[model samples]
Target: MDNMVSTCPICHQPTSPEWYFCPNCGKELKAKLIKIPLITQIGIYALSIFLPPLGLWPGIKYLGQKSQEAKMVGIVAITLTIVSSVVTIWLTFHYLQSYLAIYNGLLTNPSGLSSF
Candidate 1:
């Protein structure tokens, strides 16, 4: 097996590529970069913006992976999903309350619409 070695920027010490922090300096190591296709990122963001709840599945999946970009997209997707859900629920409740008010008014005065 090949032991890959890397230099730490903070301590200027040799460290293993797999190490998460520098042994000598205790500085955090940079995560290995994972390249994701541009199209995939766009698609993920598009789904997140259009269908936030559905997008959360992909977001959570990516978040569990090691890719930093994927994790970022996942966070954004989760945020958008929560915001969208809140707005939708608020709007639905508001509209339902308005509908109930109209229904109650009609029930209280059946002749209310007779003039119309």
Candidate 2:
């Protein structure tokens, strides 16, 4: 069983690669951004357009992180959510208005369909 371990620079204590902070001295082990691929970004943005609530997960996740790029992505995600919500609402209202007009016409004259 090869149990290889690395030492922390600050406290000379053994640390595992997966550990972000040195357990003995609280030294930061590694600082890196969790990268998101371009395809995934496009998918998230697409989800933002289709299923807005589902799309908000990435934005909320990135916004709470401590990276500038992540924050920017989060801001963009939230903006897309807002914009999509507004567009969805507007489209719903527009369609509903048209449907109600047709329904009212049907109520006024049930025999109008035979003319077509």
Q: Where does candidate 2 clash, by residue pair?
A: none
**lDDT per residue, candidate 2, 4-114, as tens digits?**
577898988888866778888898876665666778778878888788997799889878877555676788888898899999999999999999999998889888677
Q: Model 1, 1-116: lDDT tens per residue?
A: 33466788888899886677899999877666666688887787777767767878988988887865678878877787788878878888999999999999889988856777
Candidate that would win on lDDT: 2
Off by over 4 Å in 1: 1-32, 36-39, 111-116
TM-score of 2: 0.63
TM-score result, candidate 1? 0.60
Total backbone collisions for each predicted model: 0, 0
Q: Give the TM-scores of the predictions, in the order they appear.
A: 0.60, 0.63
Clash count, candidate 2: 0
